[model samples]
Target: MKTFSAFAASKPIASLWDDAQAASMSEPELLLYRSNLLGSDLRITNFGGGNTSGKIDMPDPLTGQTAKVLWVKGSGGDLGSMKIDGFATLYMDKLQALKARYRGLAYEDEMVAMASHCTFNLNPRAASIDTALHAYIPKAHVDHMHPDAVIAIAASEHGEQLTRDIFQGELAWVPWQRPGFDLGVKLGDITRDHPNLKGLVLQNHGLFTWGNTSKECYENTVRVIAQANAWLAERSDVPAFGGAVRAPLDRQARLRVVERLVPSLRGKISGDGASGQRKQGHFDDRAEVLEFVCSQDLAPLAALGTSCPDHFLRTKIYPLVLAFDPERDNLDEVIDGLDGTLEQYREQYRAYYERCKRPNSPAMRDPNAVIYLIPGVGMLSFARDKTTARIASEFYINAINVMREAQRVDRYVGLPEQEAFDIEYWLLEEAKLQRMPKPKSLAGRIALVTGAAGGIGRATAERFLQEGACVLLADIDANALAQAEASLSERFGKDVVASAVTDVTNEVSVQASMAASLTHFGGLDLVVSNAGIASSAPVGDTSLELWNRNMDILATGYFLVARAAYRLLQEQGVGGSIVFVASKNGLVASAGAAAYCTAKAAEIHLARCLALEGAEHGIRVNVVNPDAVIRGSKIWDGKWKEERAATNKIATDDIEDFYRKRSMLKLSVLPEDIAEGVYFFASDLSAKSTGNILNVDAGNAGAFTR
Candidate 1:
């Protein structure tokens, strides 16, 4: 195996402190800046895996006299992306007062509410359980982090000794204890008892460092973690992970395997996603990941589970290792046996829960594994949403680092089983879970929208995003796609939205979009086959090229898009919805526009055909026929508009108003109006309806279906 990273081997964590930058900042801004610098590097700490605090003087609300307050990272906030408001402020005096109310370890949970009462100025952000530890440290600034290098030593059997040896007695070591009121008091006593100690290591936990100022605290934390990394490097002479049991499969080969496995895996895990609350997937096969998954120690280490409290909370107690061998040609067989293998893992999890439940533990969460290790390919992590799924894979990478470094010096150790459970099902943690806002309507749904760079396609993509779906926007125009992607990504985060430059008329291009969807997110749940073209001409004047152009884009493009998405939807085995945006002409005859009318008619028929064939797989296909959508219509841009204006003997600029008057309801349809139709069909609101048509044509009598 490849050992630690080259940068990690060097072990120099240069201080990014700028005196010029720090000179103008107030204490709170400095704390935020210090935190951003620390979280910028994953080597310092994993995302959302650490807390930083600063004590500052602020005037009391009740009285004008100045008072010192503790400002710490709020619950569920990531250090990297948080704003000043993300910090929960509590009066230091009120925090100190809580110590008298502490009823010991058995009643530690009551302290969470007790701490909330200590809030300064009625700050809405909730304080985390780690609040007590920060409050009791007795320092102006404190930083508690779960760095891989530090955790490596923390998880090793000889960690306490290593802490003593490496720090030369400057840093101290505390045995494993869950964080709460008792642990906080103990930490306070330990620091007060040993005034010379700069910081300490908590077994199976993390490092806590303090200083007179925020800068000092930040530097001290980095210095200690750097020392640990260098010390481990000097001793790591042997190959990591028992020298790797098999070589990694090449990239293309691995993706091919992943494309096959992820769909089937997602389908089985989602259990049909009928609730619209399903799992989205993220996969990683980086060098470190490949080394670990292809290693001899993979099984034993994975079974022992993660060590840090933050790590195990995101990833479960153990990962389910798939029965796959990269060296053999047995992928087909392994895929076939996934049901049995997953069942065994589920049974093991059930047994663990049964063995560990206290009188009032929160009922078991989704029994399926969050992390799935495919020996040759890489790691697959799934969660209720895409960003979380990606975060799970990232956290596991940290676990891999911990295992690698611990093995280099001493045998790795995990937390005691019952202790792990206590953290997992803690009542405070359960309350946090309950407090989470309800998920959005399309939360966990993944969709691909063709012609999404502008107009109706763009509108549909935005609609999906607004309701909590990850969208892959596809358009043949690269520039337009880039612009659309930037706008949407800015509105909804970049993680939930991606784009692929695709010409849906090409079979290969359409298939590549599916692969792109799988690569960006796990698999496909919805397909909007909306790419189209419009034309109008007398039969004699309309060239065969014009006829074929309409046929190619409107008819063939829809077919290619449907066929590709159907494969992923079927493989995923989870139910899916496909909404095709045809046109009013699909059902209505028009003068001198036979080619355009026939092509749209064919598009609508295709959806009905797909609705028939897809029913067996629980895939619903429906159509939305939009007419005279002048605003933001890519079809109304040039030739089609002129041809239509001439056909109706109207002026070019008045086409929109003309259509408005033509509709029975006299409504001028906009792209956003058409999007509402797509949303209705794609969402579970239409879960029971299939092979249906919803028209956004402003009461066009010619196109009404009987």
Candidate 2:
């Protein structure tokens, strides 16, 4: 992992612009290049927080005449990853003409709709609310960014005066206003009124700089933010967060406490599935988070909330501070009180909503807090998916910097509840939410698949991810495990895929795998116990050690995985699904395979028992049985194939075809076929069915239940 630094006071934000790299790009390409360079550094901007725009002369399709067009980052586009298509293009003359129809601040939202009428070249990318800010600036290029160093000054009590003192009229100041056409018009007035102004700081919001070219605009932004850092560094005599009231626990001790904390909190924060939506979690125990959480002013500063609109919108207005004592190691005490504490936070959120609701405001959103803080441990953010949770936590880190710096230089201030409510529940924002595509079936679900490096196991993991589940792939083979992880990560995303080399038969390893689930993706939701082996031997030839090996892996491994998953599911209170992969031999007699058949039968029975025990807690346990699944199966890749073929008087290479022809349906079963069965049980489609056996054996009446 890369070292974590929260923008050191002594270190300045440097320019990353390369003139040589910019020489060959067209105007629009340069805009993309400039945006990427600025967005690459977290110190300059948080994810999806800033935007860049350039005015270019492109030929109008109608008359083949050159027209001036405004190209700005589209709504919901991230500068770091966006291509040229991510920009919204509009005719500049049409944008300015809308001013003639503007009624005033009360009609700002209506003006947003008119921007679509001005779309150029049939561009479908929607213009952001900040479009007008870029449009009215009157410069060839405009860069609006949310730099932590600059926002620290903007969030302070004396922000306006500080801007004057630091920039000496080079950068101007605008008071806090919800982003809209009115703010944009006001910015235009400021620049038009003062030609000497280099940029302007939006009070309690962000910074704005403009230039005649993209490179010049990019340089001005970096230079201004760097100068702000230099100014703050010179005044950094005050200790951060009032000089840290408590020290962090040792690494192992912290892990011990967090292992207990996450599952309990995850269940409570998920609202016990009352809302029918469970959240995925992300944990950050890095040094940057520890500095603030262990400080004397953690509570008050966190309560005051974050300043930037981008920060507060991603995170909620404020964070929920979990109660834990580092000195006494009272994690048990903390766990015991999570229920009441969580309920209290919900009540607080609801009350805030009630107080701030407008008649036309969008109905209250999920009332749970997005951020959670533990004094001596770290922070955890929960959202609809893993990436959202991770990004939310990052935005909060930006908030921490804003608050810590603002406090040292002057008193920090967050937006009033009403102002924050207005922006969050704005009609424009509501429309964007409605436009979002529906989430996938397993969107926020997290799963762990054992033997994941093998064919069936890897197939099941991919199926889960395709439905939007974050999966942890566990296996005993290190090399196979690494290969499977890379392949799955390439297909899906690395952010949602995690892997660990785990031996399921061992209690310690099973326990550690559960810990990995918590740390990697908050907590577990589905557990697939599919690890297996094959052996063929007559009753007399089967040794005690051979029978024990079969029983140890097939029976005990399933038991261990189920036992650990049950604890995690119960702790989460969100309930879960556990699917066990046994074999068709468990039901049908296979000659010379007494030990394998007996262990397989034991696995089936154990699942039944677990199903009975888990039902009351909302945990569902099911089983899938496959017959002669040789293709792509790791079991078939070993001597087991030759042993089984010789025992049954069949050629080793033709065993799969022989089994397929012997079946009632004469159809061959593959790993993907088995994966389908597992997916059915793991998803909500089978929510009402439990303790059920699904046979994926291509119709074997010999194994049919009577």
Candidate 3:
């Protein structure tokens, strides 16, 4: 349980605010400056899990009048490199009217109306739940962040008090409220009370601040967080937790637990013994337990938050505590203890709800505890979904670290049990749950694949089609494209595959292909920018033509395809995925192939930018960088490949072996291997993943430093 110094955390927040304020001086470039701030903040966070907004006093379209409007982050847009449409415009007067009303209208109704106001725009996007909060704030620019360090602190027991003590006169503290209009009204009230507050600390949530300028807002946030970090460091010593270790639970025992728990969970949990217990199904093997002993000699469990308050809906608050004793080594006892703890947790939860309930509010279901505490070890969170489980585990680990530090200062101060309950059953969040769009895993799915004449692109397209998708296959060689289409038609019928004979390098051709995809498939679900010309040349002597050619086809081509896909996907009102077929060169440069390496690297960045931009539209984008995908097609005929082979002074036949041996695992990198990675990116399994670069290089990239 390592706790960061309060100084360390608070310093960045101060610096960021200063920077943001400085950037705000240029009003004409406000949009650009704000976008840059958004991008920087997004990069600071793991993904663009945070958001930002700006208040603009604009003239009304219907009348020659000036009125304020809130331009807030849209639903699917990434904070990093956000575009104009990534923001939804809400009538400021209407928002103010809603705020004044205070409590009558439901949060869901407010959200729907706010979202509907964007109808004037050609490409309308959904408003984020925080739109109301942004609208209520007085500042011109608003920024919200989910920085890892800040979240680490907020997820702890003493988060609220620590935050208050750290920020002191400079910040305002708001209790945890579900993000929406209700939160907006609550925040509005706080703003009225603390008119001069520079930033806000939302307990168990994230941080938010606003400024007359974007720079002020950004810098203030940074400074405030830094103060908290410094306070933490001054108070306590952070202990190092031991590294990850797998549990010794056997497959049979794991199966029994899954069987017992799955029925109680909301979603169907497969992959247990009944689903033929694959390696992926074994939770114990997948789980990592990090052990930390309390250095302060305090009760370790009391220091942390009750797992993550946010994860309460998914995994119940507390875990089954297993104390380590010399006499209890039997595995059966441990399992029975776990079951008994769950039973007790359920009964206690019901009692707690009964005590806290309002007259009209319905009682919540007795939640199953998500965590398991091992006396000698720390804690473990079990979730039906891997993502939820992972977030819960991380949250627990972070909370433990913060709690340890907080105890040294003023004793652990967690949210009141009632406060936690309020958040778990917040009406605004409940409204969001009800309004959640229906799942359309691959609904209205359409895909376009470059180099789809053969190999990985072909295989990926086939997989997409199998998952109820329509595909457009593009290839430079007309005959090859036709032949590929014919073959695919025989296997998947004529309506499933559309052929486009165009070089991906040509902007017009790329645009045409994308258009054809939309026309034929009715919409686009994915874009697999797989077309690439490989080249092997040392950096200094690499030919300009060869370099330019590689860039034109691989890097620029990916950009063009992604750009077109963005338009079509947004038009269709369905989010999509973009999978770039960058080689492992994108991750780690190979010995030769300077031109190829540079292009691939650029492609990877392109995917990241697109992912950020596309998020607001429910679009997800990721890259699959494979090493030595050589199941089909000869690159020898391509000029870049021929020159590279000659430069390397080795026959093309030796290239595959050179890469295969470089990897720790002596597995050949096949098209199928790369295709699977592409499929994962394109599927609903990766709903929360964007700007991710998955390596399907058979441990090659990880094994080799460069």
The clash count for each model shown is 0, 1, 35
Lowest lDDT block of 10, candidate 1: 2-11
Expressed as tens digits, the lDDT of each residue in 85-185 for candidate 2 is 99999999999999898999988999889999999999999999999999999799999999988899999999999899999999999999999898999
Better of 1 and 3 by lDDT: 1
What is the Cα-based lDDT of residue 386 in candidate 2?
A: 94
User: What are the per-residue Cα lDDT tens digits for candidate 3 across 1-706?
Assistant: 3343333434343343345455435442454455555456421342335567777767677775886767777775665667666777777677676545454544344554544654332337777667777777777887776554455456556667666666666777676666777777677678767889887767666677778866666666666656666565564454323221233334444333333332222111111211111100112222223333222332344423352344444435544454433135444455445445555766776787887776655557534556555433334454432333555555554455444444445454455677667766766557666686653344335678998986887888778776656678998878878888998888877756788987877888987786565334334567888887777777877788978998899888888888877876664444667888887777776676778888888998888888888889788989888776765744534554556456667676676676577677877888778888898998878879999878887786352434
Worst 10 residues of 2 by lDDT: 1-10
Q: Candidate 2 has what TM-score?
A: 0.98
- Screening candidate 1 with a backbone cut-off below 3 angstroms (N, C-alpha, C), the clashing residue pairs are none
Candidate 1 segments whose C-alpha is farther than 4 A from its true place? 1-11, 272-276
Ranking by lDDT: 2, 1, 3
Output the TM-score of candidate 1: 0.97
lDDT of the structure predicted as candidate 3: 0.61
TM-score, model 3 to reference:
0.50
